[model samples]
Target: MKFISWNVNGLRAVVKKDFAEIFQKLDADFFCIQETKMQEGQLKLDLPGYRQYFNYAERKGYSGTAIFAKDEPLTVSYGIQAPEFDHEGRAITLEYPNFYLVTSYVPNSGAKLKRLDFRMGWDKAFHAYLNQLDSHKPVILCGDLNVAHHEIDLKNPQSNHHNAGFTDEERQSFTKLLDQGFMDTFRHFYPDKEDIYSWWSYRFHSRDRNAGWRIDYFVTSKRLADHISDSKILTDIFGSDHCPVELLTNTL
Candidate 1:
C-alpha cells in the first residue's frame, strides 16, 4: 500500500495550480491533506475512485484536514477527542482492518511563541490520542507535524534554534511522542541523509536555496517498521510550500 501526505496550505488555492494533475499522477491508495483552509460547502472535488473525508474547521478559511482513500475505511473519525483542541479540524483518522491511519495539521507555536503554551498542551493531548489508538492497533500517522525533530531536520538550525518549529520545547515534545513506541519512518530509513526537506519559507528564495525543514512526516508504530518499504520526501513535486511525504508498505 502507498500513502502520501501533503500540506497543501489551502485546498481551494492548490486546485487552481496543477493539483489535479499531481493528484492523478501520484494516485496513492491513501492521500492525506493538511491545512485545507476551507469550510463545508466551499468546494467540491470530482475524484471518481476515492472516498473523500473532510474535517472542516468551525472558523472558515482556517485550519482543516481531509483524506482521500481508494478503499473505504471501516470507520472514520475527526479530531483528537479533546474538545478544546478539536475546533480547528486539525486531525482525521481512518480505521482499516489492520491498522489505523491518522493525519494531522499540528498547531504552530506562532510568531514570538505566543501560542507555545497551547501547542504544548496540544502535543500532550495528541500523543495521548495516538497512544490510545495504538493500543487498539498499530498506527500509520502522517501530515505536517509542524516540528523539525532534530538539528539535522532544518537547513539553518543554529540560527533558528529558538524559532517556533525549532524550539527546544517543541522538539522535546516530539521526541517524547516518538519515545512512546512510534517511529519516524523517513529518518528510520535514512538516518544520515542531509539537506532534504519537505517545507520551505516563501521569503528569501528559501525553496530555491533548499533552505527548508523536514516538518512533514510518515510515522508508524515501531512494530510496523518491517512492513514499510520506503519513506521519502517528494521534493521535486510542487504546488505548495510543503512537498508530499510518502510511505510504501507491504500489504498489512
Candidate 2:
C-alpha cells in the first residue's frame, strides 16, 4: 500500500493552485493532509475514486485535517479520544482492516514558546492514544508533527535551537514518542540522507536554498518497520510550504 502526507497549509488556497493536478499525479492509496484550515462543506473537492473525510475545527478557517483514501475505512474517528483538543480538529483516525491510519496536525508552539505548555500536554495525550491503537493493531501516523526532533532534521539547527519547532521540550517529546515503540519511517530507511526536507520557510529564500525542516512524517509501530519498503520527500512538488512525504509498505 502507498500513503502520502502533506500539509496544504490552507486547502482553500492550494486548490486554486495545482492541487488537483498534483493529487492526480501522486495517486496514492491514502492521501492525508494537515493544516487544511477549512470547515465542512466550506470547500468543494471533486476527487474521483477517492473517499474524502474531513475534521473541521470549531473556529472557522483555522486548524483542520483531512484524509483522502481510495478505500473507505471500517470506522473513522475525529480526535485522539480527547475532548479539549478536539476543538481544533487536529486529528483524524481511520480504522482499516489491518491498521489504524491517523493524520494529525500537532499544535505549533507559538512565538516565545507561548503555546509550549499546551503542546506538551497534547504530546502526552496523543502518545497514549497511539499506544491504545497499537495494542489492537499496528498504527500508521502521519502529518506535520510540528517538531524537528533531531539536529539532522533541520537545516539551521544551531540557530533554531531556541525556536518553537526545534526547542528542547518539543524535541524531547518527540523522542519520548519514538522511545515508546514508534519508528520514524523516513529516518528508518534513510538515516544519513541529508538536505532533504519537507517544510520550508517562505522567508529568507529558504525553499530556494533547501533550508527546511523534516517535521512532517509517516511513523508507525515498531513491528511494522519491516514492512516499510520506501519513504520519500517529494521536494519537486509544490503548492504549499510543505511538499508531500510518502511511504510504501507491503504490510499495509
**For all the candidates, what are their Cα RMSDs to the real structure?**
0.5, 0.8
lDDT score, candidate 1, position 239: 89
Please state the error at residue 159 of candidate 2 in Å: 0.8
Q: Which residue pairs in model 2 clash with each other?
A: none
Q: Pick the candidate with the highest lDDT.
A: 1
lDDT by residue (166-252, candidate 1, tens digit) is 999999999998999999999999999999999999999999999999999999999999999999999999989999999999998
Model 2 lDDT per residue over 136-250, tens place: 9999999999998889899999998999999999999999899989999999989988888999999999999999999999999999987889889999999899999999999
Report clashes for each candidate as comma-separated counts: 0, 0
For candidate 2, the TM-score is: 0.98
